[model samples]
Target chain A: MGLMETFFNLDVLHSSALALLEGLKLTITLGLTSLVTSFAAGLILVLGRLYGPMPIRVIAIAFIDIFRAIPLLVLLVLVYYALPFVGINFSPFWAAVTALSLVASAYAAECFRAGIEAVAIGQFEAAKALGFSWTDMMKDVVLPQALRLVIPPSTGIGISLIKDTALASVVAMPDLLKQALQAQAFYANPSPLIGAALLYLIILLPLVRIVSSIEERQKRAAGR
Target chain B: MTHQKATQPFIKITDLQKFYGQFQALHDINLAVEKGQILALIGPSGSGKSTLVRCINLLEQFQAGTIEVDGIEVKEGRNLNKVRAEVGMVFQQFNLFPHMTALKNVAIAPVRVRGISWEEAEKKALALLERVGLSQHAHKRPSQLSGGQQQRVAIARALAMEPEVLLFDEPTSALDPEMVGEVLDVIQKVAETGVTMLIVTHEMSFARRVSNRVIFMEQGRIIEDTPPEEFFGCGPKTDRAQLFIRSVLQGHPDAGLTAPLQVLED
Candidate 1:
């Protein structure tokens, strides 16, 4: 029962490793689906802030502020537990995705809005002078540049989204952390915790590299 | 002046007035440009020179005025689509869409605004980009290129719309000194093709070199309007024009038409 032998215990490690692998798929699925939804929703919200009529702009601002203020854990508990009584039952898998995406979208929207506005006012005028309509301005010029400006932040958001998937385990979605917990319970050893940590690291490390490299390039470009 | 008979006075501005909340930005401005003529709008920044050109395409909706481009009468809330299609405008910032390659940036209005097929629009975009001396940079995004190259791309984007008149809003003002020459060169080439142009610029030498007529505006009014030759160097008809020339030459743009001189002066 020495720390060294416990660390290398093949049986405990094997159980958790298998469970981690099984949970990895759901984690990825949740991350990707919610990421896409958040991106789309965020983009629209940014556009609303920029060009929408008064009511629309107000709604967008309010949505972004309110959700951003709320804790993600509270949002999750509500979507998973409270909504069912109101007749909005969803599987724990979907509940986690919905809650995460809503919060993510709020933050993403703010990021995009700031990015879009970061483009010089002259860019918009140039588009108009060049005979582009409002929508064409976004499709051709504004969003493209703004998206580049926002890319590093958005990728950083992805890491948070992936980590956030761990919260899904609380709702019984069988994501990696939850499986790790179950394996620990079954094997009666904490060695499985190491496997879980390894899985989180494996998923997050490359992303960290990508985020930093891209962010570095963005900075270089900005300096130019 | 060998003013083109068929080419006609392609642009006419009548009684254009603009107010920004109670402050007047442009007041009772009037101007005219014959076909193939290069008209330079020269003045201090807030002199309403840029505002006038922007109004021709309704980029800024004037409180009261009428603008006729070619044969089309432009007024408030009227259909500007056709007028914008026929008139090309370039801006100082060279707002080529950052998301697009120079080629895609050029092709967008033609494809979307003008309803041209994407392939056809792209072909025209490439040719025009070449004309502006940016053929090599057609596939690069705006950020990847220098300011001069981006402005040329902006020019190419405007030309792709095939407008009868091109507008330049201090096209070289935002450029670095080294980059100004290249963008002005592109503009000069466009002028050579006999397309009509209206430009607002502070590059006094450029205004003289490229303009057939240079108009000086001050405090939302046309202080003086004269041919390039008379607009610079020396003059009898313009006490205002002579004074503007000497100040601009000495790099003292103090003729506060937009912002007061103190902030820039001391």
Candidate 2:
């Protein structure tokens, strides 16, 4: 077959577009769910690591270090394939989300820690001297400032998590990449896979632009 | 002196010794402050002026000390908020919450810590902004205000707590030269309200004018503690304090030695 027929066949892409759309919907759902879960889990983990008593801090540190070091694909396979042998069965979707959140939460925790530490010591002293309780200080003073600082990095994590949703296909979750693979097999053409890549790009490009603009704005704010 | 009815001092520090990992920051410090008295702490840098003020509110833990604020003995593991609520502090950095408007900065502690209604706290906060001559700037964030205005807001924030004792740790040290007068004016107003104040300052003229007592410290020890008139006029009893004062006078050359010397005649 010629190159266009093999990889860029419009007819094949048009025929498979509906199936790809269904997969894209699932991918988005998975990505959003994991994004929220990981972000929240990251916050809790960071708080524990920074403020909790000895055992919780140790456990949080271990969890962050181990999950951050593990390969996502290996973790996905382990969650989907190994856990069933141990009498714990998660559906493909839950398994994918579990694996993605575990790894992404570790990254998110580090980002939050960096942001919190970057807050000036004077800010903490001011809050403390005002007689703010620890919880109130974090909520009203420290976290608000830290949240602004972590936006660019955290959004970078979110984008990577969305792209990682493609890895869900390995566990039979029928996400975008899996659907693309099926369409390619049925049509005997690679155009469906290229079309799936294009769809991912369509959704992600704007987010990438937003992250850069936010970073640019923060730099400008800092410069002033 | 109207608030000095209690027989006991409002704040008492006994044998206060502070350390930072084997480096002593304060040594054998004992002091007493009566209610409504403004005591200015003067010393070289690293002489524990800031550390001593911080210890009163338990912002810095001491290795050995008994600091009693308004008769409550400060200690570790005690609820520091209880102590801090009664002792407001103004920092050199101003340390105003950059994210908040000046009004919110002044009002937040009262609303959150004192459990006052937001509406009431804001009203009081506005009055405080007016007192500091920044009522028009109340809506601006710290980033929008100049350093002096920010420090005034900081003083207003501290005053909103209605603290019995106020600590100013080089309050005007961080401002541009032109801005110092405005902040000092607000501090003078606060001092007039008769809050017991411990001020760590390098402004010799301000210390001589505003504080009743002047303390000269060096190497973490108090070398001179006397009435501001005596300390700045007859000059300090200790040679160390005398030398320090002479150097300070030489640097500023306008710290108003003549005024304090005139006070000696009166």
Candidate 3:
């Protein structure tokens, strides 16, 4: 038999599909939890960097730079293994979330900062002239407009984070990649690896398309 | 002494000085505006006319003077929100909130700053828009409206705040010539309401028609401050003010016809 027949055996493909399906639920949950945590943290960091006092601004900048510089793999290792030495122990799932969110938040914060800065200074001046306090302006006018401007970039970040959840398998979280590896070992074939790639494609293709369309609409709205 | 000497001015500025890095933008300026008075400020570019108006509302800080708006002193580290809530400013660029409709732009401050109910704010905003002849366009955003229409909405927005004083910083200078008359007409109507106002403008005729007093500045110093008729009457005043009026009015033959300064010059 050809290599394709060996790899694409019906029995192996069926079993691989079943195993991967079981892992999808955990993968989705991991993606969602990390995304929400990262987005909220990112907003706070962006605001701190942009409008906070000197001490907070310095700390936020340092945090963003450090997280962005570290590889996700190293961060996961540090959170899962090294953190225990400091008497802080998190389960593997919590470890994956903490590590992924920290790294994702750094990138998202940059995206939010760029979006907020892109709004005209005149908007703030007008809001101030109307007697809006700093916090009021941010909540009522600035953030609403900035969020609209950032949708495409933030979606890009979200899609990247979803794919990065696969890295959780390193800490043995039994996510999609881990389940596929187990199937590969059991079946002694690479078919499960192919199935995992297809699953990623299925999840990410619609997200990528949505991001592109939003970018196009934004450009058109800007009269470019 | 002037008749205004009998009553204290609602807005007062004394020994005002402003600096931008190494450059001085305003110097030792003293001025006052009585309630129900309309004062016009006209000057060549870089003369700090706009800066002076900005200083009154605490939009620009002066280094050496005190500005009192309706008894609230303009100072750093004070609760400026109370002062701002009482002073409404109209900008050269209109500066309407682009994301909101005209009605919302006019209504938002009353709701957010004053804690007025949304229903009442919207109702009052609609009335203000009607006063500006923009009732039919209440739902339009700044980006959807013409420059002139947007400015009218801005005026209505300022009016909705029920401010003690209104400051216009060259409100019509950014409009096309044909569009200027509509905005000026709306301002004239606003003036008729007897609201205290300070206007910084280049429209000499409108300044003469609507203002009780006109102030001319050069190099950050007030060259002359007098009644509009006297300021434009070719009487004894700063030569710089005379040259500025002449240059700005050069193309219009019928300029100053009502207050014929040319005859006085001859």
What lDDT tens digits, residue by residue, belong to model 3 across residues A1-224?
78886766667889678789878778889999999999999999999998899999999999999999999999999999999999999998999999999999999999999989988876877787888878889988899889899999999999999999999999999988899899999988888888888888999999999999999998999993
Error of 1 at B246 (Å): 3.7
Interface RMSD of each: 1.9, 0.6, 1.0
Question: Which segments of model 1 are wrong by more than 4 Å?
Answer: A5-8, B1-10, B68-78, B98-101, B133-150, B175-186, B203-209, B228-236, B249-266
Share of true Cα-Cα contacts across chains kept by each model: 0.67, 0.76, 0.57
**Once model 2 is optimally superposed onto the true structure by TM-score, how far is the C-alpha of residue B223 displaced, in angstroms?**
1.8
Listed in order, each prediction's TM-score against the native is 0.87, 0.95, 0.93
* Model 1, position B97: C-alpha lDDT score: 69
Cα deviation of B171 in candidate 3 (Å)? 1.3
lDDT tens digits, residue span B1-266, model 1? 23335655678788888999999998888777888788888876687888888888887888887788776777534456667778888887776767678899888888888788999999888999888888988899888999889888888888888888898988887877789888988888888899989899877767778889878888889988788776564552667666665566566648533212221121
Q: Model 2 off-target regions past 4 Å? A: B1-5, B252-266
Q: List clashing residue pairs in candidate 3.
A: none
lDDT-best of 1 and 3? 3
Give residue B45's error in model 1 in angstroms: 3.9
| Candidate 1 backbone collisions, by pair | A141-B97
lDDT of 2 by residue, A95-187 (tens): 999999999999999999999999999999998888898999999999999989999999999999999999999999899999999999999
C-alpha lDDT values of all predictions: 0.82, 0.91, 0.87
lDDT per residue, candidate 3, B134-217, as tens digits?
Answer: 999999988889999999999999999998789999898788867989999999999999988899987777888899998998
User: Which has the greatest DockQ?
Assistant: 2
Query: What is the C-alpha local distance difference test score of candidate 2?
Result: 0.91
DockQ score of each predicted structure, in the order shown: 0.42, 0.85, 0.69
